[model samples]
Target chain A: MQIVVDLTRCQGYAQCVFLSPDVFQLHGQEGLLYAPSVPEDQVQRVRQAVAACPVQAILAGEEVAAGGG
Target chain B: MAGELRDGRIVVVGASLAGLRAAETLREEGFTGSLTVVGDEPYPPYDRPPLSKQVLIGGVPADTTGLPTRRDPDADWRLGVAATGLDLLERRVLLADGESLPYDRVLIATGTRARPWPDAGEAALDGVFTLRTRDDASGLAERLDAGPGRVLVIGAGFTGSEIASACRERGLDVTVAERGPAPLVGALGGTLSQLAAVMHRGHGVDLRCGVTVTALLGDGNERFVGADLSDGTRVEADVCVVALGAVRNVEWLADSGLAAGARGIACDAGCRAFNMYGIVTDDVFVAGDVSRFPHPLFGYQMLSLEHWGNAVAQAEVAAHNMINPGPLQRPHLAVPTFWSTQFGLNIKSVGVPTYSDHVVIAQGSLEARRLAVVYGYRGRVTAAVTVDMAKSLDYYRHLIETAAPFPPPPGAADRAIAADVPIPSDVPDPKGLSHEPVVALTGHLPDRRLMVVQPTR
Candidate 1:
């Protein structure tokens, strides 16, 4: 599964990091770093992180990939 | 569970973040039941965190802050209508319009409303405001856009401080009157709040701490002109924002058999509502700021959190539990997390800081205004707050979740001098504060030294 975090919308609430630490990490107070590609084992955790985001900044699935590899 | 109950009616009361998210989650979990979401507000669910910051700063219009729907929950939205009462025996929700809607399961997420000024006449003044709803934000934002000569803010809680910051960012004069010793004292405690005071003063805000607004004075036209303080002084301002805090919307459930009270509705870890007799009810669920649930992490204390992350987490748990059986249910055990951007600082917190007796600067330095304060109770880590140093918070959160010892081991990432003697957290009793704390330790106070005394001879 593919996932992307809308950096523009994210206020660095860090819900994603708390739920899927392997897939997302907060670099500083505001800089959010996340893996765009989700591994098979981490899909459920990524999905949960997507739903848990307070700002709804996480986007999952290939439908939202926007032609990115 | 009976096969006939598969397509039951599920009603969600409150159409804000929690209500909307729960409804969507119910659908995602394959709940083929009829979903009805009721909200007192006219508009759909809208994001509120930006209301105080971006909206007030003209970065975004208040009306445009509506939350984006992930997938249509296919629920019947009853907006602009209030839920008057709940009939546990009949399994129905009574609406304000004299209509009763039967439901097999109900999720109570009525949330809270901003506490208004003591006097109705004063609160009704044209320039006096209390922010909680979208309309309130829009009105206040409009007032701020009009360039009020000077703004007087009562209560220096997160909202009040953010409002003062927004006003200063707009180059408007702001005078903050806080009944507490300093801004954010109720939430972050004394040491960090001192830094907050520094930030507020440095930002050109006329911060007046340890003072309470006795009365809001108005002109003959009923427009707010100034306010009288308990310290025998008056602050003349064109606008006054009464950021006193929030009151739970549980009055409507006063007669409801649910365990609803001043703190909020009492619910079990699985988001199942309990009756007045303390028996958990399967049909009625609770979530959002309106629900107080016990957490093992906090020593089973019934924590009442008004944080955005908690509302979402609890709502999802409640929604999932509503559709599944007891053995398949999951507890809402996520640690409370919240963040605030104010006074040119990004402050984030995890766990309940109030549930601690001591705090230590785990990383960075207070002098740099970039540090993480780890809170502990009885030598066990409980919470941590970071200012411009959020990357190190997850480490402290791990320490808290693992029940690590206080003055945490110094080997973690970006580990500072953990041996720095832990100081008293200086968290005062909530009774002494004017602003409502975001996280309330509704249960036992942690680390109360109870001496075991033997029978006197």
Candidate 2:
């Protein structure tokens, strides 16, 4: 699955990080850092991260190769 | 019946603390149906109470403000996409990303946003800030740690007052400008606001009352430098915090045809959203700061509360009713409760004090800086506000709920005071001292706009 985040709206609440640390991370000064895509097996964890965000800033979806890779 | 219940789908917009709790409660109530939660921001649900206090004071790290959840509800979370509209007829929610989610039941818990500075250019300046989210606190905390020359805070609402308190706690020079005659007049009424003003002044706050910020000044690089007040006074400061108040997140529901606006989405006593025509739907419910519900204790007045306790309690009620049958449905009638720590005093309020016409010292003495002031309307207790006397709040809260007499029952022997304590006439208007009563009795206006819609022949 693919994850997309809008940095401007991301408040670094770290709720996503707490729910799915494997997918979402926090950088220095608690800035938001996350993986854009993950294997299918991790889809459930990624979805949990998305639901736990306070500001509701995380997005996830099925992976799709660009231009028919 | 179990299969039907399991087949139902519930969708909650606004992944706020209230929204998340409601979602958790739904499952706990044996809701095995599919659940979908939609939010505009990219991050998931997190705690907000600490953002203004502990996060600002640097006691707790900003990134660690996520609400402690006992367990996770496996649900589809559509984040980073705004819920643009609700199709009540179709039982679907339209997303900004061109996605539509169908649901059997919907919960509208979208909360409020900070009211930003009116001026675009000035608000865009570097040092201007508003505390509502974790990022806001982190940025402001960083600036405070950098030690600005002076911090100017406009508006003395709870959020504004807390920011100023944190500033003083950090030993940074701070100035507070309030448009109302006294600080917190909009929420607590005039008498308590005066005490709040005194508290702020006693703590060395450059407190200015009855003044509005006219303009914010910026340097050549468009960084905030100072501000100009309506009183024709120019003040120089390194940072400015606009804490005007909150704007309800109802614009997204504009096309949804729900009774949503600046006041918030109007809901029935049971938390059911009312359509534009005033019709209530069983499938759609609302909770938290976003939902304007009528309080029976306050003469069924529509109240939009920003209290933390109200949010959690109302969400649980809304969630329980959403799944339970009619006989088991209950109203969210919890007495409003909120507290603030400012200038070395703990201030707490029970009930809507603004709805009262008079305030009397019920216990303790104002001079002692520890007392409970009971607000009354026509001899009936309507609200209570306390300064460093929170332990007495629960008792007062019962008085408010029971519509107890104004003088109130005698306190414990240890806390007994003169029953005829002075009732000051210095209450200020929320709009301003020159304005009329802070709480107005506006007659009901039926959803006339909704009435105009004719059902298909």
Candidate 3:
């Protein structure tokens, strides 16, 4: 699975960080520090993080690689 | 536009967070239909929570905070237009432009607007501002950058406190006045609010609790200069921000006869709106800050929440129901979760604090500005609040979800010693609060919108 965050839309609400800490983290007061892709076992957590985002900034799917990976 | 056509035409009002999400969900849930979205704001859907924090402090651009769409909703957006009425018999949405959009189903996600100061003349003062729209934040940020001598904030709710926190972060002198005894008393109860009061004072915020700003004073040019307080004291500040809660955007639904009121348009657990006579409407649904729905955990009281999570959660549930049959429809039962960062502390809460009768410090201590307080009612855990202890919030959330016993059993904590003494939760009467609850239990307040209901009056 692939993870993508639209920096323009993210207001640093940190909803994604709380829901999927291993995949997304709040690096102090700077912003989110997250992995762009994760193993299949972590797909469920990544999807949950995407849905929980207030601004819908997080996107997770196989498209990250297919869109000219 | 992405989903296959499996159904009919759908209209979503208020092109903000909830409306945008619902439009997407309808497609994601296999609803193949033409969707139209109407919004009063000129811009496309944008993020608002940052208006008080980052935007005010110059960390982020005000006008550029647009929300990202995961997948195209393929919605025809009627921007800069308001929906005037809902003609149920004809199944059409009347717009301000005199055009009506016919729909098989409609979603109301109108959300809310900031409550302005009572006096129109006072509100017109040049330095007076209300933070709700991006424009408001951009204007205020420009003023803050000019290095005002002092900033007077008229409330101490989450938004108010966040603004003050931003002002302090910029090294500006700030004064906060609240009618309650302490900051955040209305939402987190007395004990926790006390910590908030101390944190503000410690961070050099001139916090005045148990007092209200009686009148806003201005100069000959109608520029705000100071404020007169109920405590017989006057605060001299060049810029005054009215952080007095919000007015649910339900005025357009006034004649819709869909159980709409100041408390907000009433909806059931499935996000189905109710009519004036208390009958649920099938074709009409409500979500976001505008909808008031009953929650079983909170004794079936209708909750009107302005939290970002509730808006997203309820929208998903409402959209799923809009596209599915009765047997497959899911209920909106997500536990309320809220978080705020101010005064250099990370505050987090889960469940409804107002629904509890007793509160105990399950972990940490207030003096340190780091603690987790668990709330219980009738021997069952109802809520949990943590300040600078964000990690432990989920632990307490577990207790509330399972209806754990009050004064939770010894050794429930990871600490050697835990403070579990029961005390009155001390949730204030919402009527006396100058600010609205970010997540409100509507039954307690005498009025919903703080301003005049009718202009003729």
DockQ each: 0.07, 0.03, 0.08
Cα lDDT tens digits for candidate 3, A1-69: 545565434556788888787767653352454565465777788888888888787766432011100
Across B192-301, the per-residue lDDT of candidate 2 in tens digits comes to: 77788887888788988878888899899989999998899998999998887777898877777787866788888888999877889888999998888888888888
Per-prediction backbone clash count = 0, 15, 1
Cα error of candidate 2 at position B368, Å:
1.7
lDDT of 3 by residue, B364-457 (tens): 7886667788889999989988776665666777787788888876544454244558889999888888898877786545566353333212
Candidate 1 lDDT by residue in tens digits, B1-457: 7343347999999999899789889988889978888888888777677788767876567765566556768888888889999999999999998998899999999999998899999999999999988899999999998999999999899999999988998999999998888999889887899999999999999999888888999899999999999999989999999998899999888778678887899999999998887899989999999999999999898999998888888999999899888788999999888878787787889888988899988887778888889899998999999888766667777898999998788845555664377888899877777788888877744597553423223
lDDT, residue B250, model 3: 86
The deviation in Å at residue A20 for candidate 1 is: 24
The per-prediction CA RMSD against the true structure, in angstroms, equals 8.5, 9.5, 6.5
In order of lDDT, best first, we have 1, 3, 2
Q: After superposition, how far is residue B443 of candidate 3 from its true place, in Å?
A: 4.4
lDDT of residue A20 for candidate 3: 80
lDDT of 1 at B243: 94
Model 3: runs farther than 4 Å from truth? A1-69, B1-5, B410-413, B416-418, B443-457
What lDDT is reached at residue A63 by model 3? 24
